[model samples]
Target: MTDRLPLFPLNLVLYPGLVLPLNVFEERYRRLVRDLLALPEGERRFGVVALRSGREVGELAGDPVDAVFPVGCVAEVATIRPHADGRFDVVATGATRFRLLAVDDSGPYLVGEVEAMAEPKGDDAEVMTLAVSRAFAEYQRKLTGAQGRGPVELPELPDDAVVLSYLVAAAMVLDLSDKQSLLVAEDGTVRLRAELSLLRRENALLEHIRALPAVELLRQGTAPN
Candidate 1:
């Protein structure tokens, strides 16, 4: 059976085992925050879909929205602060993965009926967590050199395999599609491998860009010589 859940279409994708902080300022999303807060704790789950196309969430205006992938992660609000302007600052933690069924038009915000996807069990979880951590460390090293500084220090991750997986994935500079794929992955091993692949690709691209002659890059409108 499909269960209805509030939807938030974001330019970026969210992954399971990650915590995302969002500024809820738009009218519809603000309303979405309010509605979730008003619900009982168990029913406070919401779906996040990476918007593939279209500029605005509700104003598709006959333009095609890149079809939302069926798989997404459900998030539960972890922390919420109401702003003076009636907006919200919310930190949401991924809870479970879900597959979208249908989107309802009769709501202030988009609503979708989704089927929850079960997580995989076993020993590979630890292995995957380690892989993600290793890949992330390498990615960070490259990114720091490219940007000329390291990211701010983050909290230490838990020793538990599951929590570690989420923590590492959250810290990577993954784009929306990559994050979404991680969210829907059946197990930590799968997610970790995917993240590592993305990190490698990004590093390779950055190296390639860095190899170009400064003057040539400038001519291509990329950088100043």
Candidate 2:
């Protein structure tokens, strides 16, 4: 099914079951949030598309549509606090992913028609799940060593594969484009497989760096005149 919803172009990607805290100071977005809050609690939802290349507050100028990525996730308002200065602080939970169809430019803020993506399916799902989890652990261990941090327990994550995929992707310290790729991937297994490959690549790079001798930048201070 398709529905018209408000568009919020942001610098972050929201995965299903993930919680995002936002500060709404921009006039247009403040209006959008206020309107959504006025609706029934169950209907306080909006689309959060990654900003491909543009500012969120200032004029998008020519074509606002070009600034937003096609794929986005729906954010359901969990709790909202309106400030006396007309700003807002909100914590929203990601619900579902959607693809933007057509933009409606008449509103103060950008609005678009979107279709929700269907549930994902894949082969050897269990195998892929284990691969993602183990690879992530290896990567985390390597990353911790590089950061000079002591060993710590890995975060406990959801057992549900679907939510697990998102949690892992969200927790990863990766390039924005790489994270976007995982978000756009079709299903949990596909995302997990892709993440596993990425994690392995990162592990390799970290290992190579660890093998290199550390450079001592601070030379014994010779008495300088």
RMSD (Å) per prediction = 7.4, 8.9
lDDT of 2 by residue, 64-115 (tens): 7787778889999998888999988888888999999988878888898999
Report how far off residue 125 is in candidate 2 (Å). Answer: 0.8
TM-score of 1: 0.73
Candidate 1, residues 78-188, lDDT tens digits: the string is 887899998787888778778887788576777888988776634566776676666666665565556655464534446555555555555665556666666666676
Clashes of 1: 0
Cα lDDT for residue 178, candidate 2: 80
Error of 1 at 6 (Å): 1.1
lDDT of 2: 0.77
Query: Candidate 2: which stretches are off by over 4 Å?
Result: 54-59, 210-225
